[model samples]
Target: MRHAHTVEQVRAAEAELAGQPLMDRAVAGLAATCARLLRERRGRVYGSRVLVLAGSGDNGGDALFAGAALARRGAAVSAVLLSPEKAHRAALAALRATGGQVTTDQNVGLADFARADLILDGIVGIGGRSGLRPAAAPYATAPRTGLLVAVDLPSGVDADTGEVAGAALRADLTVTFGTHKPGLLIDPGAGHAGPVQLVPIGLRPPAAPVQALQHADLAALLPRPGAESDKYRRGVLGVRAGSERYPGAAQLVVAGALHGGAGAVRYLGRPGAEVVRRHPEVLLGDGRVQAWVVGPGSGEATVEALDATLAAEVPVLVDADGLTELARRGPGALAGRTAPTLLTPHTGEAARLLGGAATAERCAAARLRTARELADRYGATVLLKGSTTVVARPDGTARVNPTGTSWLATAGSGDVLAGLAGALLAAGLDPFDAASAAAYLHGLAGRLAAAGGNRLPFGSVHSTVGDRGEAPVTARQVAAALPAAWRNATAPQGGSQQDAAGLGD
Candidate 1:
């Protein structure tokens, strides 16, 4: 799994490494990465034009030192000091000694930047708040055909929250020191960062609040049946979804549940005929179940079904219409439940559940905070779905899903996701793990369905549909790809033997 540390956590690690020249080590790594980028972008670094937009902090010092290294290696390097008076003296002198050009003129810098093959953005750092300063704004605003590489992180992004307040310099590549920042992994800020390269300076932080699951992690958590396992032993999931008006929801939900590894699905709703017609494997009525999935096109019958599910003393996954009913009844309604509860809500549903100050806009803007607040308020795990799905537990810990694609915003997608999560709940995963794992797998399924291939992790050599040229996906296609997505998730970390050895056609 990939972990992201907040700014405060990074500072604590930096404090531990105070005796070491962390800055020098970071600069050396940065210089090496820049050199490699230059070689890849062009043919070589010897004759390439490099420009360092240096500010007045440690970030600028790192950039200047890197520029000096490149200049010594015969690359024509130039440093435009945003704060010339306050720029690191030693770094400036070293660059000058290596025959690197230094200037404070914005016009000259812009001209050089426009013609340069590579630009190192040290105009701002992780500690910086808001957007680019007036002097540095022009560089960010300028048209760029050359590759832009950021030192540490892309400027103008929230290092802790991943929110971009204003104009930010988007980088083609970012070489971050010590550990990965939260901004580099989350969206908005993640969108600004192209491919990130971690330069380890031997700094270790505490356990991260946010993490992204990988293949091996999912494989370890997934439930599998043994020789002694029967249908009931594997687990039966009860799905209370759909209505007379929306029978399609029932079929979709059952599809997700069956493919999600539930031994059997007991569906209870007015649309039983339509569900059975589509999936004969689903049982028409519920007698006993390991877990229950409530709401998703439930119409007016949601309150009754939710109450029945709540009284069972088993895990329950509440979504869509059920979220509205839960909101109307408030936290008091769920207070009696001894079993785990998972609440899945889109921004609008989350806003309604939160009420008053928590508008849909606010929930979308501050997703992490909203999910945590909802989880605390209802004493349940909150899986807030959006461009970035955040799964937050009642204890305030959260996991951010990075596997999703924009094409997942389709009709009945949430119904499929809800059913899949309920199956995981029945299979014995905790509310937190079930919700997080479901989101992770659902996202991968969506990407695979839409792209018609495996969607590799970020920064991998394999490209997305946009690069390969594919079309959009429907909800059914996403459900159909569930097994493939599961296999990909459960695959060995080193990759398949056929793929690695190129033994397959």
Candidate 2:
């Protein structure tokens, strides 16, 4: 059961629970939780201490209640009140009754903070609008500190936008109640919500306003070969990409499509001609294709060929220049078509299509809004690509891809992503699944390509290209790495297939 919720939605759910007659019934449940933590950290130094830095709202109330529980488990417990007179009366009373100390001395608090086994940051939650105020700022994660945990949501993170506010605490583990906020899964705000885990808090967010990707779901949605399947029946991705100027994009996107399980990839365009020259199996021009992958390096994408793509209409992946043209004139020119439309656009193209403010730094909230708005406006699936790629449904279920890797910051990668998405669309997966799986697998592939390298992370990022050298892989390298990446990312029971060893075949 996966759930994604916005801040206001989560807050409303928690508020309703608090209004229940049995609200205090679970106040003592914190002690049981602390005992479990104690069992998990048995042999480590500073294992027994739990610091609760609390504020004034129910968010702070959760920490104080938990602090009392830690005290009962023989761990030294302390609650440092940021707001002197405004702490939750009931929760503070519980902490005091359990012998948890409330200290006023700054030095003593600092010492407790430094030597503390774990820090429970209940300083703020979904209710937080500003940032770490003057009082709560001091305890933010420093270069050296113990594991930090958050309650409900991390302080200084916009639970809706996935944007970090003035000062955010970087948590090692955030134990949130009920469901995950959008910030916990997407970038920027995701940076601060490290390794989030949700605690069942007996309340459900309304409307299911947001969502996140998961591996098993991707695996299930991915196209797989069955009986009576042939190369043509499965799907053919006609790739129109690359040029003399960008000859590499054709190879990389094709590598991606091949690994993506496309039955056949029919190469097209001037770049497609070059791709057929390199890989003799690739056919030139269009034939019968279940999907079309257009605009990889299409600096000179002809209006005639693009029109053929629109006319085919099985499932179309619009990338690079194709994405740019679609953004400007709209895919409405492809009007009166019945096949699904998939548009994969980087941040700039998405911003242009949506006709609004944009930034490489724009939070997930804005991207999500853009995706939904564009899907509705253009009548297609909008895979808005970025550090946190978002795939939205016209039906209101938008999923943020969870698998991300920094090594994916290479050129030509988007083309390969477009290919993978196109193959899935042709193989008959839902638009939402096809786009999200493509983004997730693209990132996983980058990790595999650079698996055992130095600061390069995935592998030798500076290798040479020759008979004796391994070219520093471009997007094609990542696409070539897909099957292996998927194996490493999704192989169950600690086992793997050895069919692939490097980024490329």
Candidate 3:
């Protein structure tokens, strides 16, 4: 798992570190990274033009010290001091001793900034909140001729929430010290941060409040059927999805379930015939099943199926149309459900469930808060899907999925996720693990499908809208790529990825 520490956690860890200066350690790492980037961009660091956008505190100190190191290495380094009077005195003196020039004039700074080979952004640190000050705001919209690198995080981004209250500098890369912040791994702030590289400073942080599941973590959580396991022993997933008007949803949902390691998939909806036609392997008319998934693309007829699924006393996953019905009926609809229940909703659906206070805009902006509130309000595991998929439990803890691309925002993707998650629940994983693991696989599948059945360089890959060309994916294609994605997750390091189809234990 990739753990993300909060600002408070990072500060607490810094307080516990023994004799070493945190700023010095951070500056050393920052300088090294800057040197490497300079080499890559300008062929050599000795004659490269470097500019530092320094502000008031430790962030500016880190930039100044790093500039001093670069200046000593023969780079033409200059510091644009946003607050010259309030700058770190020791760091400023060190930079001056190393032949680095500093100026407080914004016009002169921007002129030097335009011709520099690299720009080091140390305008704000994690503690500095509520976006950029007026003096620092211009850099957020400045022309990007040089390679921009953020010190710890991009200025104007909320380190704890990943929200950008105002204009923020968009870095080509960010070198963070000690640990990854919550903002670096999430969206909005993550978008500003670009790619991040962590530099260890020996600060042992406490248990992280936010974490993203990695391949090995998903491998451990995935259910494996034993040698003696039969169809019923493995598990059966009952899917109540699609109607006469939307038969394709049934096919997509079943496609996700078929490749999800479920022993059997039983269709229980208006489009049962359509589902069987598309997938001959699927069993029609559910008998005994381990878990039930309702209602993607469901019409008015789905209400009966929802009641029947809930009445069966098995784990139930509610999605799409089912969510709308649940919102209309309120929390009382789930009062009699003794078994585990999972609710999957997008931002708009979440707003409906949360009533008037939680609008689509509000939920989209505050994804973590919305997920937690929805989970607590409905007393179920809630998976709020978006750019960053968050799986929140009733107990207030949550897991954020980091594998997804914006390409997964295509139509019928949620239905696919709902089916996949239901299969995991049937396979005996608890609500939390089932939801999280399923989201992990679903996201991986989306990424794989988006990349055209090849491995993605996730560390360097930017947003789906940028870089990658027009690669449209159907829901069926995403399902078809699941086997490959599964193998990629479970395969040992340095070993070849085996065909995931027919390989489930």
Candidate 4:
């Protein structure tokens, strides 16, 4: 698991190491990474043109020290101080001692930014909540040939929420220290962050509010049948989805449930014949089930299905039209439920659930906040699906899904996800674990289907199909790839295939 600490948490942890050389450790790692990237881009670090965009904070100090280190190693390093008067005195003197050039001219900075082999973006620290200052805004749109590496985080992105308020420096790679920030894991801040590399400074903080699960984490959480396991013992998943108007939603949901790790799938809805025709093994009409999946193309029948599902003592997952009905009825309908309730909604549905001036655009911009608010208000586990799928628990803990492709933005993808999560719930995982595992597997399946096979290594960090030269895929194809994704997640880590960073393109 990759833990993402908030700015306040990072500060508290850093305070514990006040007497130590934290800045030195950070600079060493930054300089080493820059050297490695320089060597990879060109032939060597020596004689490479490096530019540092220095702000008034510790981030600027770190960049200047790193630039001085590069200058010592024969790299031509230049520092453009955005806040010349407030720059770190020690760091500035150190750079000057190393024969590094310093300038406060915006024109000189832009020129250096254009032609430098590498640009270190330390113009803003994690504390910065808004967009870039006017002096440094030009770098946001300036054309550059070399790689732009962010020191801790890209300037102009909210460290806690991943909301890019205005023009933010888009980095080719972000070298973060201590631990990951929530912004680097979620979009549109994630979109600006190309690739992230964590540089540990030995600051141990409290439990992280945000986390991303890796292959091993999922492998441990995934349920597997035992030797003497019967169909009932494994777990039964009850699905109430689709209507005559939108029968395809039922088909997709059932497909996802069947492939999911459930022992049996009992489907109840208007599209029973169609479902049976597609999947003969599906049991028509609902018997006793460990969990129930309601919604997903439910149309006019959503209210009835939701009431019936809610009446059951078993765990219930609400999505799609069911989510709309739940939003209309408010959280009162789920007030007396003894069983767990998992609410899955895309940005639009989430906005409706939130109500009161909440729009899809606002929900998308502040995904973490939106999911947390919904979870708290509804008193249930909320899975807000989007470019970065966030699973938020009512207790304030959350997990950001790091696996997925743009291809998952298909029509019935959410239905497939709802069914898969319901199956996990039936398999006896808690709401948080069920939702997190389902998102991970669903994302991997989408990647597999988009690639047309397991052409890319299982659990690859490339988040998009375009990252690996793949094609578009349908929701049906995504469901079909579930088994392969399951096997990959359960595969031994010692094997040739393994997952690296959970967050990526």
Candidate 5:
């Protein structure tokens, strides 16, 4: 994973760098790099004139300096001073010297803001808290003219808390200085920053981190089975899910697991062994497994089945009915596991698991805290799935899966996810990837499933949205669509994306 520095860590690095006289030149050099990016993309930069929304501090300084560099490249760059006399004097002066002017007149500024090629937000940084000052407040969510490049972070985002204050500007890109701040990594704040561009400013060694993940870096850490692998060697997954009342749960979970790349999946509980009747490939009565998935559609009687699954010497994925049992057991049962355990609880289950914690607090902080507190209590990885999925480990460095579409709130979907995740663990992927990839693909599957399915996340992917969409998506249809999802995630570049018809759009 890419190492991320917290706000304090970046500040210490800045202090050390700023202590050296050469650091000033380095600051200019970094500014020059941003200027170069602007210069090379000038037409796009100005076909969009750069509107620099300058605030009171160094964030504004960076923007004004960037404006100066943009002006030098023939792009019309103007700064709208929010703090008036309190603006960064040196950078403002430098911008003025380079023919980049500041305008305080509201009408004229608003007009320019409406038709600009790009707007550079210098309104806030790591030093700033959430909430907008009165003067610049209106622009927070107003219709923007073009792509926005935030200087450090968008205005009104708490640099430390990752919470948005009263109003916040949403940027297309944020060019962060020194190193990443906590706000640039965590959500509600991270979401506002959009994709980030980390620019080095000769910063020093790291400190306590906030958040980070590197695709290639983490990809390397994921376990892959070799050709010598066997069913037992490949890792076995035990699934104690579904019942006579809800047999599809078992089948879908099995479907998800089979494709999840597991060595073998063991069946337990009622209709589960009978699931082997149809999917006879699965062995009944778990001998041993690397991972266990229980509780999907187990309903009230799932307690015993869940208990048996939890007793294994393998990682466990607790979902649905299993989660309900886990809740009644309190957080202590997880501490007793002989193997690594993972909880795939949704918000309501999480609330039941977390007890009295406020819904917002749990939604905001539970993911990070769950892995720690629960891991410390139960020694397991906590993969809390929701609108904002957070996967935390017993070890630090919590990762938030960044890819999501609002299309995954469907019913019975969690069964597929539990199967997929358990399958990955059985297949030898680290618990982190097992959980995260399952979530990512779950969301992707939802997007594919609902493209023409009436735009409902849980309903079906079988609507007439596309004039001539190829096929309607059923459970089988969604199952068939997963290969493309896997391909997109594994593709080297931004691979050819398919439209609703499952054809290249």
Candidate 6:
């Protein structure tokens, strides 16, 4: 698993290492990475133009020290100090000793920024909550050909929540120190931080609040049937989705459930005939099931379905119309329930569940916060689906799905996800594990389907949009690709375990 620590946690860890040369370690890693990139781009670091956008604080100090290193190696390095008065005194002195040029002039900085072979952004650090200040605002829209590398994280993004309030620098790569920050792993901020490189500085943090599961992690969590396993022993999933108005929802949900390692799926809704036609393997009329999937396209019957499903002492997954009904009834409806409850909601649905003073647009901007709130308010595991899907438990611990694609925005996708998650719950995984695992598989399936069934590498970092060479995919195609995704995820790692961890070069 890839762990993401908050700024406070990182600070605490740094405190433990009090007198160590943490800055030196960070500067060495930063300069080395810059040197490698320079060689790759222009054949050598000597005589190459490098620009450092230095602000106040250690973030800027790291950049300045790195600039000094490059200068010693014969690179033409220049520093643009956004805050000259507050810049790190020792770092500035080091840069001057190496003959690196420093200026407080904005126009000169813009000119250097335009022509440099490489740009290191240290205008803001992880603690920056607002957008770029006036002196550095112009760089946000500046046109440049060279690669822009963020020192620790892109400026103006919340370290804890991944929220981008306004203008922020977009980096081609980010060299983060010690550990990955929560902002770099989530959307909005993640979108700005292109690819990340971890540079350890020996700061040991406690338990991470946010985590992303990799291939080995998923492989360990996946439920495999033993030799003595039967249909009943493997686990049966109960599906209460679809209605007369929307029969296709039923077919898609059942399709996803069948491939979720569940032995059998019990269909119980108005669209039973349609579901049976698409999947004759699905048992008609539920008798006994380990878990229940409610909602999807059950328009008018949502109330009845949710009531009946909740009455049973089994793990229940609520989605689509079921989420709407749950929102209407309030969190109190779920009171006194012993079994785990999983709620999957897109941003809009999540906003509704939150009720007072919440809007879809606001929730989208603060995905981590919104998910935690929903999980706490509903007293269940909440999976907030978006460009980055976040699964949060009532205890505030959360996991972000790293495999999501914009191609999954198609209709009926959520229904499919609901079925898959419900099936995993039936297979005996807790709500948190079931939701996280299902999201991982579902996202991988979407990617596979979008790429015309071509098997992509497991745990590869995916953009908000689909990966390169991918085409649009329908919900049915996504469901069809689940088996392929499952196989790839469970495949033996051999020597490619590092690639399976999603650590980029």
List TM-score per model, in order.
0.92, 0.84, 0.93, 0.97, 0.82, 0.97
Segments of candidate 6 deviating more than 4 angstroms: 457-460, 464-466, 494-505
**Candidate 3 least-lDDT 10 residues:** 496-505
- Cα lDDT of all candidates, in order? 0.83, 0.69, 0.83, 0.90, 0.67, 0.89
lDDT of 2 by residue, 1-505 (tens): 2567876786677677776633343344434544555567665323388788888878888888878767766667898888768788888998899788897665666678887777788788687873688667776744435567777677888787676657788776676666778777666666677666556658766877676545555566677688999988788888777777777777777877888878888887666666766666676765888888777776765455567787785787777877777766764765676887788877777766666566435524466666777778788888988767878777767888765456566787887788788877777777778898888777667655655321123322211112122224467668777886565545562112221211111
Off by over 4 Å in 3: 454-463, 494-505
Cα displacement (Å) at residue 306, model 6? 0.6
C-alpha-based local distance difference test score of model 6: 0.89
TM-score winner between candidates 1 and 2: 1
Clashes of 5: 11
TM-score comparison, 1 vs 6, better candidate: 6
**lDDT measured at residue 413 in model 2 versus the true structure, 0 to 100:** 81
lDDT tens digits by residue: candidate 3, 408-448: 78898888898889888999999899999988888778777
Give the per-residue lDDT of model 6 (tens digit) for 253-326.
Answer: 88888887888999998878778888989999859899999999989999999999999999999999999999
Query: For residue 376, what is the lDDT in candidate 1?
Result: 98
Ranking of candidates on TM-score, top first:
4, 6, 3, 1, 2, 5
Tens digits of per-residue lDDT for model 1 on 1-505? 6677888899999998788999988999999988988899887889899999999888899999999999988899999999998898999999999999999999999998899899999988888874777788887679877899999888877777777777888888788988777777666677677767788888889998877666566777889999999878878999999998887887788898888888899999999988998898989785879999999888989989999989988899999889999999998888999999999999999999988877898788677778889999999999999877889998888887766677788898998898889899999899899988898888778867876776544322222225343458888888888888888778775334312221011
lDDT of 5: 0.67
Candidate 5 lDDT over 365-446, as tens digits, reads 4345544455454456777776457677776656665444444555666778888888888877777777877766655555
Deviating ranges (above 4 Å) for candidate 2: 11-47, 103-115, 141-144, 204-207, 302-305, 330-338, 363-365, 452-474, 486-505
Number of backbone clashes in candidate 2: 5
TM-score of 2: 0.84
Alpha-carbon error at 333 in model 3, in Å?
3.2
